[model samples]
Target: MSLIKFFVLAQLKVEQFIKETEGASGIEYAIIAAMVAVIIIGFSSSIQNGISAIFTKIQAALPAASS
Candidate 1:
């Protein structure tokens, strides 16, 4: 009976340990932050390209000033 009780307590402890979410939250947040960084980097490159194209067109449209 005592041996059975020990095994049961051990099993419960293992289950409780497995169910813990405290340490996992940090990992989840890190993954989310990494994803956000990747998205921002991708968007910034496209935005920079678009702005550069617009400036190039504007520069081409305006005539050069005399020195």
Candidate 2:
């Protein structure tokens, strides 16, 4: 193929790819979901630790049972 023809074909392909948005939106949603998942995972560990400490404090506050 001639150089000009090759460049024209390449440009057309690029324009067509840019015009397609379905895959772009899906990729964006996947990225957002991944970030949200990471945030949830990070918060879960902290929340678990906080809940454990609260339980420990509650146990310490309780009076001992009589023998």
Candidate 3:
């Protein structure tokens, strides 16, 4: 009888552990989002410079309007 009770308790503990681990998926997604945000922030200056260069080129190619 004692052995049976021990097994039941062990099973309950295992179930609790499984339930706690279910949050891991959410944590994984949060980690991925943070990494992507970090990467974007790291490249932001380069992206801005590229965009600025493209616009400058376009402006230079356009003829100035006469007054």
True-structure lDDT of candidate 1 = 0.92
RMSD per model, one decimal: 3.8, 2.7, 4.2
Candidate 2: list runs displaced more than 4 Å: 61-67
User: Candidate 1 versus the native: TM-score?
Assistant: 0.52
Q: lDDT by residue for model 2 over 1-67, one digit each (tens)?
A: 9999999999999999989988888999999999999999989989999999999987877755432
List model 3 lDDT by residue over 1-67, tens digit each. 6999999999999999988977899999999999999999999999999999999987877766432
Q: Which pairs in model 2 have colliding backbones?
A: none
lDDT tens digits, residue span 2-48, model 1: 99999999999999999999999899999999999999998998999
Clashes of each: 0, 0, 0
Query: What TM-score goes with each of the models?
Result: 0.52, 0.74, 0.66
* Candidate 3: 10-residue stretch with minimal lDDT: 58-67
Specify the highest-TM-score model's number. Answer: 2
Model 3 bad stretches (over 4 Å): 1-19, 64-67
Model 2 vs. true fold: TM? 0.74
Q: Considering only N, C-alpha and C atoms within 3 Å, which residue pairs clash in candidate 1?
A: none
